[model samples]
Target: MSVPPRLSMATLPSAAGAGMRAPRIDPAALDIGIVHLGIGAFHRAHQAVYTEDALAAAGESDWGICGVTQRSAHVRDQLVPQDGLYTVLQRGTGAREPRLVGSVRQVLATTEDDVVARLADPAVRVVTLTVTEKGYRLDRHGEPDLRDAGVRADLAGHAGAGHRPRTVVGTLVSALARRRAGHGRGLSLVSCDNLPGNGSVLRKLVTGFCAALPAPGGEDLAAWVAREVSFPSTVVDRMVPTTRSGDRDEIARTFGVTDAAVVVAEPFRQWVVQDDFAAGRPAWDRAGALLTADVTPYEAVKLRLLNAAHSLLAYTGALAGHETIAAAVADPELAAAAAALMVHDASPTLRPPAGLELSGYCDAVLRRFANPALGHRTLQVAADGSLKLPIRVLGTVRDRLAAGTEPTWAALAVAAWMVLLVRGRTDDDRVLAVEDPMLGHLRTQLGRLCDRPRPHDAARIVAVLLGVTEIFGDDLPAHPVFRDLLTAHVARLLTPTPRRPSRSAGS
Candidate 1:
């Protein structure tokens, strides 16, 4: 496998274009056929790296990425100066290294007005998305929220001649409609988000969007989408810390060229995608991807255990006054608490394969969370609580309640949620938004509840929020077990901890 020239270092060895001796590959050789949405750091560090590796290993260059950002020109400004090339810094427990990835041939801001027309092109055969779960604009049943103002607006835009859709689902619907009308080949819509059954979820959202369109060709396009477009669910893993101001100098030093958009991630990476595609795909298997028959089990293990635990640490640790993931893990109390929650509570919900014990997995997760070098933040994990909790915590809660099983960890996690949501303040005076989907209702209740006993009021507030079918999809209030458990945790959190004197003794 030849390193792409633009990425090859000039200072290394020689095969006339080997190692450091190899000149950068010509950018013209790479085709920008991939229209990727949500040009975020995770997408760059994970999917982009794999795409670059696949192209390099196979000696093929037809699948360069044309990144599309729904908001802001930050990435475009950063990558344009470097000619769409950027460095990926992979830091692990013991090693730190950088690789120049040239898979992205161009970047575009969909806000540019002309971007929708570009997406309609037949050349863009694959549209990948990392637009977070909220980007799906899903209703409580995990269905697409078509009535959302943004979704409605985008769909309306698609109906107007020469107008372009903005949301990814809208853009996909409009593109498929155009392709069907133009007799063009259909494209695959691959979702690289962390949601479970992501491929199916994306398919449903696109279908939902198409169903909303009034054009005569809309149903025809839906039929085309059903027959021509494939949605492959994937399980992706990588710890990409947000890029900081210091990353610029670090990237410049490593690549010998500056890249403001350079992404930093831990060395670990994994992708298990279902082996199904409507249009052809890159030789990703050549780059070590797991092309499985069904990504269900794999996706479940990652999403339920790995991501769910991450969220647990984020919410519970933030409430416990920890800042970074490593700091939270350093506390033996917190680490044990999280491990017990996973191993005893949530792991039963997942049916992992033989020889893959949940206990061992929990151990590994604890170590990963404790990686001081990584510096992953608690808030970063906690940021999207409204979208995350239902998948991470409530799934276990629902299963336990149905089976008449005691949900200790799930209850504690819900308790942690209340503590996290109620205060919106840190010891350092940092303000949290408590940006749950039910924020408006919670605030309205909080105004009156402060006068009453906090725990009683907290339980009521939680009951209302959890009962929102659009979020939790269940009448949690109906379950006495859930209500009681949440109430208990909320009581623990509101109670003051006993103080201890230092080695010098009390004054």
Candidate 2:
């Protein structure tokens, strides 16, 4: 395999027009058929690489992506200067490897107001999203909040102005509306997020938005969207840690050019998608993507074990004052606690896909999380607990209750969460700014429990916190056993560990 020639960003055509050589790629060699909603680092390192490999394997160019940004033009400004070619630095300890990725063909600033016109383009057969889970604007109940201020504003403004909205769900709704009015068929909408059943979540959000609209043919359009559009469930895995300033300079030094939007990530990547598409999709399977008939088992495996464990490490590590995923995993105590949580409680609840080995999968996850080269921040994973925790951890809680089993580790984690919430600060909170939508609420909840010193008081606090059915998907307060375990574990996590570890409860 020959490496593609590295072109200097200063030599691209855009820079050429400004009396500098413009970094340029032959756009004719690639077609822009896929429009991505969030032009972020994770998308660049993961999906873009998969798409590039797919195109290279099939010798086709119709799958290049048109990246879109909602709020800022930072990515646009950076990529346009580089002619959409940038280095993806795969960093390992003492080894920083860079690869030039060419999957992005063009980019649009969704805030430009006229971006909807581009969405109606006939050439576009698919619209994918890597927008973080918070972008969905889901209510505390985990359901789409079309009434969210941003959602309402975007919908009203875009529909009234004959333009597209910036939010992924709004943009897709606007595009589906336009397509229905003209071409009568729309593109598939794929959500590549960490949420369980993200595809269905997206579909519901879009459909609900359409259903709420006061217009003729809204139901018809919704039906067409349901029938004509395909929302494929996917489990995307990659560790693209937030790039540091030193990383930026290193990328420029290695590639011999400046790229403001260069993404740095670890070398691991995995994408599992349900092979359900309305129009069609890139040959991602050729690039080792597992395109299965059903993604539930695979999703369960990732969501329950990988994502759940990540979340546990996030909060627990933050409480323990660890900075990164690698650092947290290095703690024998933390590592032992997390491994015990997975092996004893979470892993048993997940049904692996056929021919999939649960133990092997967990070992891989543990190794990946322990990679000292990846500076994946604890706060980054811990930031969105209001949106993440219910899906990632509470499922195991519910499953344990259903089987009449004791959920000690899950309870302990929740206890840790409540304790962290009560503190109103992360580990080293004075130096770091941690933000979550429910931070204020968490603080309020914790304040109410300050005077109570009884076990039942802790149980009440845990019940009240987890009782948000929209977030937890079930009424967690009703389970006495769960509340008891959570209360007990919260007590344990708050109690100072003064000695070597005891045998894990569920283990």
Q: Identify the leading candidate in terms of lDDT.
A: 2
- The digit string of per-residue lDDT tens for model 1 on 1-507 reads 332223222322222222211213445588877889888899888888788778877788778888888777888877766667666766657554555666787788877746666667777788888998788888866566766887889877875786766677887777777777676687788898888789989988887777777866667678878888899888888888887766766644443444567677877788887888777788888778888888887776777677777877777677666767777777666677788778877888888855677778778878777776666878788877777877667788787777888888777776776667766654333465556666666656555553333554667656655666665665676778887888777776666565222111011
lDDT of 1: 0.72
What C-alpha lDDT values do all the predictions have?
0.72, 0.74
Clashes of 1: 8
Q: How close is candidate 2 to the true structure, as a TM-score?
A: 0.88
> How big is the positional error of residue 408 in model 1, measured in Å on the Cα after superposition?
1.0
Best by TM-score: 1
lDDT of 1 at 483: 79
> Which segments of model 2 are wrong by more than 4 Å?
1-28, 93-96, 140-143, 155-158, 162-166, 426-432, 448-460, 496-507
Q: List the residue pairs that clash in candidate 1.
A: 5-23, 5-24, 5-25, 6-24, 6-25, 9-20, 12-20, 140-470
lDDT of 2 at 5: 30
